[model samples]
Target: MTGIVTLTAAGAIDATYRVGALRRGTFTRAERYTREVSGKGVNVSAALAAGGADTAAVVVLGADDVRFARGGLTAPLLRIVEVPGSTRVNTSIIDAEGATTKVNAPTPPLSPEAWDATLSALRDELGTRPQPWLVISGSLPELAGTGTPVDLAAVRAAAREHGARVAVDTSGGALDALLADPTGIDLLTPNAEELSAAVGRPLRTLGDVVTAAREIVARGVTTVLASLGADGLVVVTADRAVFARAQAPSVANTAGAGDAALAGFLLGLTRGPAATAAGADPLAVAAASAAEWGAHAVAHASTIVAGPPHGIRALVETSPDLDRVLTAEGEA
Candidate 1:
């Protein structure tokens, strides 16, 4: 793939509030507030575009907000799919310690017809670029008439037709569906908890995580990038696994670190090949870049990369310590 094209099945207007330590059941006033048109795919696309990568996002927007979506997120990077409903507003409360408390609204339902239209739009966008990575992020809303989850297979089919590799970032039943039939998906990004649930086991140590990711690789997925908040990232392929991490200078917000990491990894892929640490394996290079970008994301208050990326270094291990115990704080 030469560039990236993201599809956000569920999009939102993210409202973030900065406040002191939250007092439960009391009126906690916010010290600052910021709003942005966001979704997991939108966040990825934003970060990639900021890094000067060719990227576009196909977002499902409520008809009421479609008119204003371009004003917030640039029109060039976004392809809007309007459906009948009001856009959901997701709220985030960041405490003084940089801890985030998020309240995500219920996903707006989409009819099968609307979903078909959305997929058609995504396919059309993919055609615009010769070869692009199709990144599907965010939760999949159910069909209004059927009450069944959105069909991810259709998305894979669309990607296959355009010769695009698919990368998925989602959980719950959606994750189950992806795992049940890992046909066209090339990359899967899951946090520690999601990986544990995928293998139906508890991942107490790095070894457990690696072992679990291998199972996914065996199933058909080309690579699994597991996010371990503080512990950094673990990338597992069929033959090898590598771990990468970087210390964050500060933690201002962690809402979109994973998305930023994904963007960084994809950017590395778009730049031909990278050979920094542990030889010139694309996976290692991408993992190291992912760690560095994720660390930088937490240092900013916005959900997406804001400006010029500062210099940051990452430690990549070709042979990671499998027995290392995972800490409670490493949850992502």
Candidate 2:
């Protein structure tokens, strides 16, 4: 089906612990615990699938851990490629105040041969549909001997070959490389911090964000969907911008909210014609959906969403107040 296909170059076994409080250099007791197979692309695919979208995740796992990762995820939704060592483990700690502290282990670069296998798997999956949306999310690993990042350009090339659109959600050097020449990127989802980092300045107001997003839009990216925490989300393009926020829910965990938001955005875009027929701009529809789905994700303690979202209402503004101050992440 021509829906969404995701690539998770660095996958992990996620371990979450809920504690009353975290004390540095001291023992802490956890009140709850859960674990699952997780990666940014995995989370996006899972959320989209739960929301009834045809989605699949291409995950690279170690030979020893592939079985365990497979056991936790739906079989049809996964395309696993095996490497040599064990898969990395990431730990998350949520406190009583709903704050999340995450410790992610470093992933060693895949060998050139293994990297080729990963690309082959990606090509195989993309070949299944004429023009699927290919999402490459999460941290990227380097190539072993070269110490160079995985060939993102090659991935973009493959997507182009299959006439697929691309959405990227990664950070640091990998993100810089993509933005350096965003020729094939149709969409980019960067949270507040990532957006700040991209522009090399702090964004304290709605206008600041719009300016930064426009800079990237001018660089060839079609759309920039930025998450602003409590301030909500903003979608910016070359000619228009929209801001959307849903009624707040009691936030239990914010770990996977962005991934869920990206899933919703893709779903909305995939079904854009229906939204357009209803007299709404497809961009605004997507922003509203993203806000609602992100709200739904924050209400849960895990990255997995078992069902469709409910009880969430979004307010989208076509002409958002540019002067409005943003307080999320202490921006202002």
Candidate 3:
């Protein structure tokens, strides 16, 4: 239960410009900021490490842009694979009120050799050590080809070969392809829209989500965690189904909420009795923990202004009232 590996994108930064105030068509003032390492995988890894898990992040970083992405990482193991080309930087602008406008730079594609090397590294890591649970999340770099999902499937195969489980948190074509032939995924975590898109239908209620989850599980997934934002989460397994609700907090930023949920749920799954017991309703427990953790993570993350990225220190410090809501009846 201790070994866990997360595969993701990585890069250094360039510069971000924030423009405030707009009169007619021109900006009144513009502010420039230096770049930093930012991506979905890094954020999820940070959350996992903050939650006291022995987590390692495997990502590709630009040759020169190393400090920005690798800096501030306190994870027990942070492995960076050097790649050519400067990493991408994204820009954002907000008016005096709070309206935001963002422009994102393009991410370079990983070379075929780089991709092969990454998979090889993953295989070697899993092969040598204890069976490490794999969390494959985030979008592939734009340049990485259409075979990204297939490549991920190969990674899943290797993990399974070594007696590990995988949680896939991605969308679009990759997700569709994976669902078409889900062979190694233990958990599928997607939001409502992504779930609807994957199932090729509209999901408007908890019942629709449950139906969709049943269909996906029928295809091949062992479990489904469909996040419904304010409506909370709906979790479905082969033998049990449950929905965990939370009182919504004031949301400042929604960037890493799902990542937080994934980390929290996985934390529960790996550490708690959820995985070992037959017909155990760990999904309800995991979903509750995920919702509570996500709400608090978003609250704390939104408070940080341009300084260092907010770690999970605050979220870890605060405990949500999960016990009051997740009684035996809730799961039943």
Candidate 4:
């Protein structure tokens, strides 16, 4: 799979505000202001492209918001579908302590005609293009009379029809919908909290995480890659289960770490014959790759702002970190 496609929401500007402290009726200075295109799918696609993958991003942008949508893209191929209104804008405020508060604007409703047009464009591209990897991520904007549901099953089916492997990173109702029918999903990458929410249980230990992940695979998922934050990652498949532990690093911003991790994992999936042979059981490799990328992302965040930096080397040096945690908790 040389080419990859990412599908999700596309918005214009990301207005980021930084405040030193929060208090009622107090004037605070703005630390930084910048505009950028941001979304989970978009970020992941950009990371993959930056990492040297033949990648494209498919997004819905209002006719008026085309410029905004295209502004933040650096990918070689970016396909946009013009809809009725301007794309959404998301605002985030980061406090000095690295806590973030975000507000997202509502997206214009997509008419039946608009949906058809967008789907048609995607189908044509996938059918005619050489992309072999498809990433369906992020949340859909609410539109009038539209429940904001993304047709994951249809997306998966389409990717498979075009001989592409699919990876999904989403949550809430959309996550529930995909888990309802996990067929055709080559990889399900979820963070620990998301995984616990999806499985309807609290996963406090590595064994618990492994058990839950295996249950997810039993539901027709080929593989389950669970990101355990500072604890590293837990990968589960029908054949084997492996855990990779990275020492807790000072995380600058946990925001894009998951997306970066996904990028790393996908990159590993397409690496070479060994990765291909590992097939769905490439959890360890994926985890290792994701850890490195995520560490980089965290490190990058630290230099620009006052926050925790993800220690890439520390994570790699700590082997069996998860095992140690499990053993200390008497769950190993």
Candidate 5:
């Protein structure tokens, strides 16, 4: 993969409001508000672009909001496909305490023609220069009046035919559909809750997280990276496992922290090949990057901004010893 290309089918107008406090039973006036076009993949692209990486996004934009999406994102390349429906709006309310209350709108359905067009564009890119890590993220839109065949597998198959590696970050039925094939994905990133939901149980501890993630690996996933809020992350592959944690940074708002982590994880992959003597388990290195990036996102006011505003190296040094952590699996 040359760089990253995200499929942000579920694009949205993201709005964030800042207020002194949010009391459930009263009217709370906003002190400030910021709005932009975002989706999970869009957020990843923004953060990657912030880190000075070349990125691209393929999104379904409302015909009217094309300029807004293009202008707000950090990506230099955008393959825009127009659909008839208005883009959904997602709202996040951040309080002085850094707690966030989010309101996510339903995904807009894609016309059969629009979906087909999107696939065609993706194919063209996969066949062209700058082979990229094709990321299929966000929720699946319901099929609208467009009687597009629900052939999601065909999309992945087409990518593989063109020799592209895929990464996934999605939940609910869409996630289940992906997990069913398991080994088809190059990487899978899930927060604890999403991991639990996928395995049909509640994960309450790190061990629980490991067990659930291991199950996904047994089903053929190449690797599982589960983000556990302040506790850090668990990165597991077919042959090894590592648990990594970093010192907690002060929280700003946790809205896009997971996306930030995924963005960092991919960045780490691009850093260099893992040097085992340097404690470089590929998964472990990726986990370290995830913690550092996640911490930085939580330390910022906006998800699109760069890490912690401090730097990534200091935080990564404080994280767990990846090779030592492998001892848990009796591999050290």
Candidate 6:
């Protein structure tokens, strides 16, 4: 089955430490730890593949692939493109209160040829097996020869040629390119801070988020899923907006929660039409699933999303936790 294809520009070994209390200027011993082959796009692929979604992960790594290979980080398909430096280790300190502090190492700059090879590999994948979603994720590596970033426009254009909808989960310079022209992206996932940075304003209220998302709609982008951390997520489309929340049983690791949300939303979209409409737009049902999947992710000690959430669709479609936002004051 043709399914989601994710490209992670900067992939890493996620090293997450669970600590009792994170104190400033003191040594905090980790109570437990876990590691996985992860990047935003990789995490999405892992979630989808774990749930039996036919998925592929395109990742850029250094020559050494053994680190990622050793951890049983098996997805349906994994495409690795060698770059200049070693795979960075992203460390996260998860305190008992669910607060997380992450230290992400910078990926070494890639040569021009490396970028070309990466893009070419993705284009070939798009042509060989077309899928509904082509996800371009994570931050851009610094270009060695010049400051010109990786050509996301080229990537999106390639996906369009193969008749695949594009979904992007990137920020900083990478997102700035989309804000300039978001013509073909079907879904854009960004947290509150990333959205605020993209629009050059603070999204303090639901009204502010709605307004910002609408502006992107004006640019021809189809959907926006803005994660509000513990407050849940706000999903905006051309027709309407909705807010959905799912309280976690226990918050163990908050690192990959947003990736889980994006994966769930996309998975729900492919799960077929809802038996009954819960709100104005069908995207609301997907958003509800996104919220629930995110909650399940945080309840686990692992940063990589696990198996299929069998009852997520039924629960989200029937539960009272999801609400369509008619007015700006809509907060779930």
Query: Number of the top candidate by lDDT?
Result: 2
Off by over 4 Å in 3: 9-35, 74-76, 90-104, 142-150, 274-281, 302-332
Model 6, span 213-242: residue lDDT tens? 888878888989888776777888776777
Better of 2 and 5 by TM-score: 2
Q: Rate the local accuracy (lDDT) of all candidates.
A: 0.87, 0.88, 0.64, 0.67, 0.74, 0.77
| Clash number for each model | 0, 0, 0, 2, 1, 0
What's the lDDT for candidate 4? 0.67
Candidate 2 positional error at 111, Å: 1.0
Displacement of residue 275 (Cα, Å) in model 2 is 1.2
Model 3 C-alpha lDDT per residue in residues 271-314, reported as the tens digit of each score:
66744465544555576667666765555323112222233221
TM-score of 4: 0.83
Error of 5 at 234 (Å): 1.0
Per TM-score, the best of the predicted structures is 2
Off by over 4 Å in 6: 274-281, 310-332
Error of 1 at 151 (Å): 0.5
Worst 10 residues of 1 by lDDT: 270-279
- Candidate order (lDDT): 2, 1, 6, 5, 4, 3
Summarize candidate 4's per-residue lDDT along 1-332 as a digit string, tens digits. 47778776543445667778766588877877665655676667777876777777777766776665555444245677777766677776767776656787755566656666656666766776575788887775544476665455556667878998788888777788788888888899887778888889888787777778888899988988788766667667776666665443454455666777788778766775576575634445666677666665654342111122244542332223333443222222
lDDT per residue, candidate 5, 34-95, as tens digits? 88777887778777777666677777778788777667545366777777757888899999
Which candidate, 5 or 6, would have the higher TM-score against the true structure? 6
Off by over 4 Å in 1: 272-279, 330-332
Query: Global lDDT for candidate 2?
Result: 0.88
Residue range with the least summed lDDT across 10 consecutive positions in model 6: 320-329
Residue-wise lDDT of candidate 1 within 158-187, one digit each (tens)?
A: 898999999999999989988998977899
TM-scores of all models?
Answer: 0.95, 0.97, 0.78, 0.83, 0.87, 0.88
